[model samples]
Target: MRHYVAGGTEHGGGIGRLIGYILTAQPQSAHDQLVTDTRGARWSKLRSPPLLWAAMAVMVKDRLLAPDRVHHLHIAGRGSTARKVILGGLARGLGCTHVLHLHDFDYASDFLRRPPWQRRAIRALFRGADRVIVLGERDRSTASDLLGVPARSISVLHNAVPDPRQSGNATLDPPAPDAPARIVFLGQLGPRKGVPELLNALSHPAMASLNWTAVVAGDGPVDHYRAEAAQLGLSDRVTLPGWLDRAQTRALSESSDILALPSHAEGMAMAVLEGLAHGLAVVTTRVGAHEEILHDEETCRFVPVGDVEALARALADLVAHPETRAQLAMAGRDQYRNALSIEAYIGKLDAMHRSVSRGALRGASAQRGTV
Candidate 1:
């Protein structure tokens, strides 16, 4: 089968990062993905976003026009639904099957609470998809209930990341006696991700005496958040270095002792999975599919969103006790190997693509190309 994976750039954040891993990190198999840029060209910054989306539609239409049985898997969310609904229709008309991978952090509140017409648009996209993939059971249930998609049509696939473990006698390797504990936050520097709350938590008196440093890495309003960090007296210890390259990110993951993401919302955060894959002690909020796989104080440390005090306490505990950090890190890595690894994710995705393509050939014979 001819497989096409379409989405944003790797630097675009969670959804983009997921597509990046699928296209680059996984081992070569029959399911290798041909790629396209739905978000836009590298110089798309100069043009309006809607024009770039139009460009994506043209790309999708071109692939569908090909003679092969195309299995187009689109990974996007939010306003991306608008263009995808059109592309989904085109895929059907062209006798090809498309899998709509719905990945949005705010589907719990923002999407479900949208006005009636907006909700209808989202449901229409779900209806046209030959197969619908959701991040977890919460999203699966939401699609079945609110979107009116059948329960069987929606598959609950947990998000995953490529394992970054290296072999050595590096068990619980903390920094030297004089070096500070490293805390890393990987995500957009925005309100939904709880960046302000993270800064506030890091500035709390509980962490005042601790020898610790933090790197809040990713793109978005860097100057504003840096100013907020300074206002909270975290300018000395906290470093917001915008977005890090793949090498820089791996280096940060390898060295950092803790990964913190106190997000207000999420759909199985890729950072949490990456932290688990890297064996870092994960300190995250209880929102999204986190509670599905991670147990509080076991595999990870769960904190409440917007609660600076709770977040501070979690960070302080991890920093003060190296043994607890080691325990969480080991358990998280074990969880990653057993459930959230890229191998497992790709295996299921390949199966889904095959199933949807076969269904299209057997049923949608009204058009040319697919059979």
Candidate 2:
């Protein structure tokens, strides 16, 4: 068996990193080959230009049709501009099984806003694939509507994370109970992340009732966000830690009581998953992927997007009710283990590949009028 997995790199705390790691863990032997095309991933973008070009060439070569060899093709996160063109042509040329993984909802949004010539080309690229994999039902429905694909063509695969277990590094201690309850935001800090509102919300009546310290652990448009926090007199309350490695971020999650992110837009938040993995309850908005996983008063508490008062109230609820925090944490940990395990994810991927392969064989036989 051969498996080809391709996707984005971990940029601070993106879901792509987790996906890449999960794919790499798949069983590989001397006979079974695994090829990864990370040409347009975050790591490749930082490498020398010549090496990047070479990697792209290699990816294109690997993606080409191989007669009699069952190919499991995955296009995810970022690929070259010619990636879809090459892969689609390969599928048509060789009729190999193809899988298109949609990480962001931007593709369909672009197809709608762009001119007809561009939209037609984009549509054709998506139409050529045998299957499309998405993180949740929301993205699946949106992609289907814009691309004119049937629900059957799309598979809703929940983003998988490692079974959340405590990294028993004795030196790493949970935050002191006497210290302010830690509130962490773990993503690129930009306008889109709702940093300004988070800052403003810190000064709200409900938030003022509790003692909390904020840790912002990502880099992007930092100057503006820092300035806003200072202007709101939240400089002391918020810590702009710039960026943290995975281990460091995990430590923060284990130590934190509340994972606060009032994102204006998100497909799904891997950080929220990470928070759950570490047994930290979440406080996020209702839109995007949050609605898919979280139930208010169940896994975590939620408020409407952009409502600072509501966000503050939710935060206060967690702070004042320590038992609630403990309960949510336990529930979130269970959710991650039961539904988003690496074992479950790999099983799903394997099923998709086999189903597509079998369907392809059946179609070829039918076209030849073989009963």
Candidate 3:
């Protein structure tokens, strides 16, 4: 069966790179049938609306030419209005089975705020899919309530990363108490990632006693965040390295003692998964599917969102106690091996694809009988 994976192409964004990884891992038998339809602006810039529409037109035409051969369409995106429209059109026009893979938590909240007619349109888009995939059970419930689709129709699939053990650089040594703890934050630097709050936490008097150095990785408004760090009196404690390539990122992860991401929203962060895979002690907010995978104070430390004091306390505690960090790191690595590895995720995805294809065929047969 032919399968088409459609999503963004930007390297910085998680969805696009994830699609690439999935495509690369396809079984040899399915490789010939696998096609990728990348949308959105390359290099993380916005594309004009007409260009996006034209790209969709081309993708639709390609699928229509081999409608019967294409058994499954996996549409991965953040569920914007345009994305919904494109997905709905492809499902109807190609007469193929499709799965809507959600990558952001804001979609449901945004749907709730839309007008009645627009809400109906959004619901229709979800209703037309053979299956809807979310990052967690929380998102599955939200999708059912917001899109009016049955809970049974949604599947919870967490984001995963390649096992760091395979890289042969997974850190096994416990952090040395005499050295400053290394904290690393990977992803865009902005309010959505809780950057301002992180700065505040670092500036708090509680953290003043702790010996820690933070490395802010990835791109987006770097100068602004750097200035904020300086303004918060954290210039000496923080380092902004801008964006790093894959190898650089891996090296940084391997060397770091703690992985910090106080995000306000997420579907499931790849950085968090990578941190777990590398056996690093993670300090993050309880957003996305994190709570499902990470046990607070066991596998990782969880702090309330935007709470400077709580975040500062969490950081300080981890810094002061190397034994606690080691325990959490080992638990995190075990969690990665048991649940969040790429191989495990691919096994689930393969099963979902087969189910979706079978259902699509049955639906087509019923439509013909009705005629």
Candidate 4:
């Protein structure tokens, strides 16, 4: 069967990387084709409405013309605009079964805040999908409640990372007592990532005596965060390494004692998954798939969103107790193996594809009075 995957291809965002993984994992028989929706250069702003429409139009036309196509379209993005365009317009008009994979944590809140007409439009787009793939239990509940879709129709698939244990670079040993604990944050350095708050947390009085260093690694306004770090007198302890490649990120993660990301929102952070894969003690806010995947003080430490004092205390506690960090790191790796491996992710996706394909065929046969 032929599968059409439509989403950002060139953008350096998580969704684009997700599409890359899906493409790489496809079996030979699937003959999957990727339809580029947005380019990386245009990622900072919304693509012109006419341009997006034209792109979707071309994708729909190509799918319609393909021979022996199963018409399994998987669209990944954050907002309802792309969903409305593809599922509501192209997929509906072409009678194609589609999967709506949501990657944003604030989708429910944003959906509720929209005008009535727009809200209805968004709901209609979600309801039209053959299957809705959400990142966690919370997102599934939100989709069911706000979009009026059944919970069974929504699959809670957490993002996965390759097992770092197999890489032979994972640091399983306890941290050296003489060395300061290293905490690494990997993602865009923006307000949404709570970089400012993280700086504030590091500057708190509780963390004054903590022997630790933090590396903020990712692109976006590095100068701004640098200024904040300097103002907090953290210039010596905090390192802004700009953007690191995959190998670099993996190396940093492997060497680090803690992976801290206090994001305001997320669907399922790949960085967090990568951190867990590398067996680093994770300290993050209770957002996105975190609530479903992480156990407080067990697999990782969870703090309230935007709480600087609590974050500082958590960091201090982890740094002062290396044994605790080691325990949490090992537990986080175990959790990754049990629940968030790449094999597990692909298996669930394949099952969903099979189910959707079967239902589509059944519907077609019934329409022809042959079933």
Candidate 5:
């Protein structure tokens, strides 16, 4: 089947990479890049005009429904209203199947909340889609309530991790003398990620009691987070290595004793999955989709968001008891192999594609492609 993995270049992370991998693995499937400007003036505004997007939509459809070819169409993670409708319109025009996979909670709703036209555009996209894919169960429930899509139309698929064949060793090993029980925070360095709260938690006496040094990975609003750390007097203990590439990030995860993510909002943290795969104890907040992969005191530990005291205490507990840390790490290893494996993800996606294709075919045969 020919899959068009459409997405913006801006929020390209594990999800984008996973999509690329799936398309690349299929010999017949050719991945197409629909590049669009994402640097909006406002934090939540359109980067380009609607006409340009409509033109791009024509281009996407032209490439997908090319003459003398058998192509099964699909678009991943609708970014903007124009882009979303453009793809859906193309699907309807070509009478092809389309999958509306969601990465964030609400893409079109953020700007299109009060506007009736925008809301209609979003609903049109939902109505045109054959299947809507979500990451976690909570996200699935929210999608149903917000989009008014039937429960059966939406599928809950957990983000999966590709196993690193080459474990860290001689060339790329964990931090030497992994003493002082170092911890790492991997992901975007933003306010919603709770970077400030983590710094505050590190300032407490309990965190200091553990002889811990932190290596913070990833980048976003660097100056702000650095200033916050300095203000809390955590500059000495915390190491801001900025953003590292995939290999470097994995090495840091392997070296650390614990991975902490005090995020205030998250779809599902890929860093948490990587830390678990690396056999490092994880300590994240309840805001994330951890309920799908983790159990309190089993595969990982949990704390309330922005609670410095609770975070400090959780870190102290992990640092103080080596046996507990080891047990959690072991459980994390098991969990990664069981639920978050790449094989499991492939199976889920394959099933979704088949189901959606069949549904679209049936819908198209009846009247039009309004699946």
Candidate 6:
């Protein structure tokens, strides 16, 4: 069996990373992909959205017509939703079964709050999908009630990351007793990711009193946050390195003691999963699918979203107590190995595509050696 996954190819974004994992985990001969969005460097004509969409439309037309190929579309809100609507419609019209994987972070404030025409596109997209994949149960209800998709057709599958432990650099040593705890934040520098709140939390008295250093990584208004960090007197200890490549991120994770996301909303953030996979004690909000898998003070630390004090306390506690931090980090890594690793995710994804024969299952398992 073959599956064609379509989505963005941005390195930092969730959908993009998911596609990367799928392409990387499964053999290319068994599974294929199409890049609907790209961080284009050249090819000026293809950079134009219309021309890119037209080119992809031709590709989709031919691919959907192929025999026994599963079409899985990963869609976010706004422009992503619009593009997939057309693509999914064409596939369905061609008598092909397609899966719609919803990764939109905003529905109430953004997608559902859109105008009538936008609502029409959203409705058309989900209702036509043969199977609908959501990152959590919250979205399962949303698709049923708002988009008129059947609840039975939807599946709640939290996102997963490639196991960092198996990356051959599994160094999760706790911070030295005399050295400051290392805190790393990975996400876009925007309000929804709680970057402003994270900076504020770091500047709080509780955090100020603790012995810690931080690196707020990811792309988005780096100068603005750097300036704010300076104003808060956190510039000395807090470093905003803009965006780190995968190698650099893995290195940061290896050297860091804690991973903090503190997003206001999420459909199961990749950073949190990555934190678990990398064996880092995490301090993040109990929003989205986070509350489902993570237990407060057990698997990882949990703080209330937008509450600077709570966030500060969480960070401070982890910073001060190395034993507690190490325990949580170990627990989180165990959780990753048991369920959230790419191997487990691929098994689930393969099942969603269809119940495969023994030979097909063997083929899927064979690619894990390559990863």
Q: Record all residue pairs in model 4 with backbone atoms less than 3 Å apart, i.e. clashing.
A: none
Cα deviation at 92, candidate 5, in Å, is 2.3
Per-residue C-alpha lDDT of model 3 across residues 1-371, encoded as one tens digit per residue: 44333344344277655655565555565544454443444443354354446545645665667554433444433434555566566666666566777667566677677778877776777777778888897778777876778877888888887876775666666555578989899998888898888888888898898888999998898999999899888899999989887778888998888898999998788889889988899999999788999999789999998888898888888888888988998999899999887878888887887887777678778888952
> What TM-score does prediction 4 earn?
0.88
Error of model 4, residue 60, in angstroms:
2.8
Candidate 6: stretches off by over 4 Å:
1-7, 27-55, 58-65, 173-175, 355-371
Which pairs clash inside model 1? none
**lDDT per residue, candidate 1, 19-84, as tens digits?**
677766654742546555545533465443555466446555655565444545554555466656
Report the lDDT of model 5 for residue 353.
73
TM-score against truth, every candidate? 0.88, 0.84, 0.88, 0.88, 0.81, 0.88
lDDT of 4 at 32: 58
Q: List candidate 4 segments past 4 Å from native.
A: 1-12, 24-35, 42-54, 65-87, 168-177
Q: Please give me the total number of clashing residue pairs in predicted model 1.
A: 0
Residues 43-160 of candidate 4 have per-residue lDDT tens digits of 5455545545665665577656852234444443444354444545576677766777777757777777778987777788788878888888877888898789877788887888
Worst 10 residues of 2 by lDDT: 3-12
Cα lDDT tens digits for candidate 2, 1-371: 33333333343135446655565555363244444443444455564344435544544564463443445444432343235555555555656667776665244454466678755755676677777777777777766887766778888877766653633552334556667788899888875676777777777778876878888778777777778788888887888878787678777776788888888877677777778777787888776667777788899888777888888888888877777888997898788887767678878877887887788778888999994
lDDT of each: 0.77, 0.68, 0.75, 0.76, 0.68, 0.77
> For model 1, how big is the CA root-mean-square deviation?
3.5
**Per-candidate count of clashing residue pairs (backbone under 3 Å):** 0, 0, 0, 0, 0, 0
Query: Where in model 1 is the C-alpha error above 4 Å?
Result: 1-7, 26-31, 41-70, 73-77, 112-115, 166-174, 364-371
**Candidate 5 residue spans exceeding 4 A from truth:** 1-11, 20-82, 105-112, 165-178, 363-371
Off by over 4 Å in 2: 1-15, 24-56, 63-86, 105-107, 166-176, 364-371
